[model samples]
Target: MEQNPPKSIASIKEKLKKSREREEECATNLQLLRQDLIKARTAAIDVVMAHQKAVVKLDEELEENAKDLKNVHVHFLSEREALLSSFVGSLLRKEKATGKTPPQPDAPRFVAPLHTPTILCFLRTHLGKPGMLYCGRKVLECEDFMLKTNRERMELLFAQHRCFGCFLPLSVAGHLKLSDCPHPRYCAICDSKDHHQILCAARRVYQGVIPE
Candidate 1:
């Protein structure tokens, strides 16, 4: 004969309730893990986007740098060409100027009015004759009012470079039409600061032409 199974129904129901609670807890844990994985994937995607943005920014910066370099190169080349053109123009202008005649210096200076030696008045007043009449002689023989010593002085101190027909001594001032010289007062003929008997009027008259 099969005896009836001794059954604790309350214990059996309690075990079943515990198993359902474990299964619900496992499902909740799985859902939480899936949510955490989705959040991690989203974060990785955001990081990749950030990296891509950085790369794009770098590419733009490189492009800008290249453009700047190109502009600088063009500008420099243009400047160089302009400078070359300017230099060539300057050379052409120089050549043109060189082909023309050079500027000339100023002309020689023209001197003033001519000097003509006319007869002086000292011999007419005092000696009654020109100084030429007094040849190589003592001063007193010509009735010269100067003393014997002065006559000797005239004879010794001075001599004739030329027998100027109408010339007078530079010392005689009153009617002596004298002339000056460009050289230092060193000429032997005129015996004055001006020119000498070399250009004196008596020589010119004797030559029959007034010195121009």
Candidate 2:
């Protein structure tokens, strides 16, 4: 009976040892799982930060592109205005010296049909008038003839490449023409909308410069 008791005690001790070993193994597995979880969390955070940076860079690039496009548009408009002014000035000098209106250039007319009447009206009012020069201003009273005339008005009227009223290029102007507002008037030199030639600021400045 004593021997049997000893064997039972030894068996119990062996079971206790095995139980402790199992506990240690479970703790090790839990620690490894915790480390894996921490690594996963770190990786996820890094990915989110990288994604945010990419988005910010994309936004910056888009803004820069928009600015570049705007600059290009402004440059194009200025070039068109300068070319038109030069062409008209040359034509006027030729016409005045020859005592006859010159032939119209064979350039492609890009102005819309709806805007044609307005251009024609402007031309009829100012074309071939005496003592008039293309100085990029609206009509003013001629000191000699007492007649209201402006050669610059004709220059802007024939500017089919852009709107002299709003200074919008043809591509944008074609899409934005107002159906209700036909025959809109503007200063040829300054591009002031809904203004008359007589009240044009540029005309006043030009008149001030004339030697009385």
Candidate 3:
């Protein structure tokens, strides 16, 4: 076999130099990649911190708004009570001065074309409460008998287009007399469209219809 050419010192030295240069370049690239990774990590941490801060601020604002709404509602109730008291007091004084009975304001009138069985059920459920059936009735009275009697009477009144609360005849109308009420029915005592259970306790107390 032919002998291989003797290895040259120059070529070997050149190969060694190229390998060393490649190693240096790889090391430099790795260092640059590590720096970029550290920067990305820092940026992610900052974003998370900012998001947490925003959430905390939003919660605080919501809490403050809720407190404001509660305060406003309480203020409104106080004002409404004061106005009602003033109106009642003025009416009483006017009656005393004139020495004539004040004309009772006509109850709100509405035309309820539909029979509300739900209202009857509600009245039966919440018996003996003010502005509800059995308000003045004794518990000893037969519950079934009373409900049966009232149910028949109410059905008759509904057919006759009469007010459920006062049994007064109602004027034919397509809508509620009270602007706030959605139902086409009215309660003189409760002055609400929801139910005409019995005489309203609040009205009785305010108008001096019942002794405090």
Candidate 4:
């Protein structure tokens, strides 16, 4: 019985040692799992920050691109106005030199019905200071209704382009038509919803340099 008691005690001590080793193994595994979890969280934070930085850079590039496009449009309109004014002036001078009455200019028609009318015609027919009878009323008065109809048509065209004012893509603020303002329109700089570009302060600054 004494010998049997020692053997039983030895068996118990061996089991206890094995149990302690298992507990230590479990604790080491738990520590490794915690370390992995912390690394995952840190990596996720870094990814998010990198994504945000990329988005900011993209936005800045888009804004710069829009500004460049606006400048190009401005320059093109100025050149177009100068060319037209020169052509018209030359025609008038030639007629006066020949001692012949200058025939009234007619607005040139467009080949595509969907396109905006020639700028010269819109200026002569819709914005002329002198009154000429057309369909019982003055030409300008008669063309007012036509201009409004054309304005609606131009909305879709404007939608395809960016806004000159905010240098962003054009939004629901109804597409501003070139006919709504004077020649070489400065609609991009004007903020007034009620007034045309002719009344804009920015427009006035460049008044005489560009033809009307």
Candidate 5:
């Protein structure tokens, strides 16, 4: 028989082969792990990018909603002004047809019958010349429920009128009627749109309403 290979050498060779196989298996496992990590990182990046895009879209939608809300508010205010103007015009037309002298805005005495119209007047003092400005009459005394208190009725009447300054006609709507003025809706002390002459508390006050 051929001389047998040295036992020690045979054992050493077997161990070397086993170690190489184990190294190859480890290398394969390491490569697979590296590939798995790369995939995981790529998926995480995609998720972050999607989240960022969604956030940007949400902000844009919110901005659009805000603009729509602002537009609605402006529209509502404009419509309210138009309605008030239209109501005043209607009253003026009624007066013209009846040939009745509607209650003057500056008259001190609140002498309007139920459902009678009261004119709101404005004076353009800033136009280099003091000119009388009048808006169409707005109806003050409506044939509605009888108010209980004098103060309540007075407040309601005041609410129907407006005065601009210590001396302005055609006040914005909702001026308080001055008790001291000759005209029903005018201020005697200060031609203001909101308060009585006594309560006007202005440094300068108008003495009386201009003669019609």
Candidate 6:
């Protein structure tokens, strides 16, 4: 309490310099850590973007593959139908009574496949050959409604029996004094198994009941 020690300026200056050096070092370390954190965040973003791009590419490839598969399926079905149609056409050609030979497949330009049904005429009957089915005859004459069939389809004609009365010719449906006579009922003409010959105009003419 009685005596005071002399202070040294050199020692105090040395302590101040050491404290400043420590604070600078801490600042540098913080800056390095911030840069590292930024680099890590950028890397993570790049990885996520890359993953998204790969997923999009895979989805596009899968879609293309699915379309290819569908096309293959359609082609397979088309080929199958063509094969069956060809088989049916071959059988019908063998049924022809003509001495003339069938047109060879390798002959020339194949209009359609060999097995496609067409309407081929042997004689007066236009029923044979390949073509569309006829449900009933109509009096209206048109190119579209005509029997534009092919020869291989002849077998399909007369496949089932219709009433003999209803089976009259198309032109006759309008000209004749006919009505749709129901089967198995008391009709004066179709009383027997054979065609109802009783409705013959000649019979009425002979009996003097009506004009011939």
Best by lDDT: 2
lDDT of 4: 0.48
The root-mean-square deviation over C-alpha atoms between each candidate and the true structure, in angstroms, is 38.0, 11.7, 14.4, 11.9, 15.3, 22.4
lDDT of each: 0.44, 0.51, 0.50, 0.48, 0.47, 0.42
lDDT of 3 by residue, 43-161 (tens): 99999999999999999999999767755654454345446555666776888899998676586221222323223332343455766555343322333323232234445445556
lDDT of 5 at 93: 78
Residue-level error in angstroms, candidate 2, position 15: 1.3
TM-scores for all predictions: 0.41, 0.49, 0.43, 0.48, 0.47, 0.43
Collision pairs in model 1: 181-194, 190-196, 190-197
| Rank by TM-score (best first) | 2, 4, 5, 3, 6, 1
Task: Identify the runs in model 5 with alpha carbons over 4 angstroms from their true place.
Answer: 1-5, 106-212
For residue 146, model 5's alpha carbon misses the true position, in angstroms, by 33
Q: Report how far off residue 29 is in candidate 1 (Å).
A: 1.0
lDDT of 6 by residue, 1-212 (tens): 33333245667778889989998998999999999999999999999999999999999999999767755654454345446556655554665555556556665322232122122322223343366444332312222222222211111222222222443332533433324533321223223332222122222122332222
| Models sorted by lDDT, best on top | 2, 3, 4, 5, 1, 6
| Cα distance off (Å), candidate 6, residue 8 | 4.9
Span of 10 residues, lowest total lDDT, candidate 1: 145-154
Please write out the lDDT profile of model 4 over residues 1-212, one tens digit for every residue. 66999999999999999999999999999999999999999999999999999999999999999777765655555455446545656776798899999665485421222222232222223344568423444322333323232223234224345332321233543555433433232233323343233222323234343222
Please state the error at residue 93 of candidate 5 in Å. Answer: 1.8
Instruction: Give candidate 1 regions above 4 Å deviation.
Output: 1-7, 100-212
Task: Pick out the ten consecutive residues of candidate 2 with the lowest summed lDDT.
Answer: 139-148
Error of 6 at 143 (Å): 19
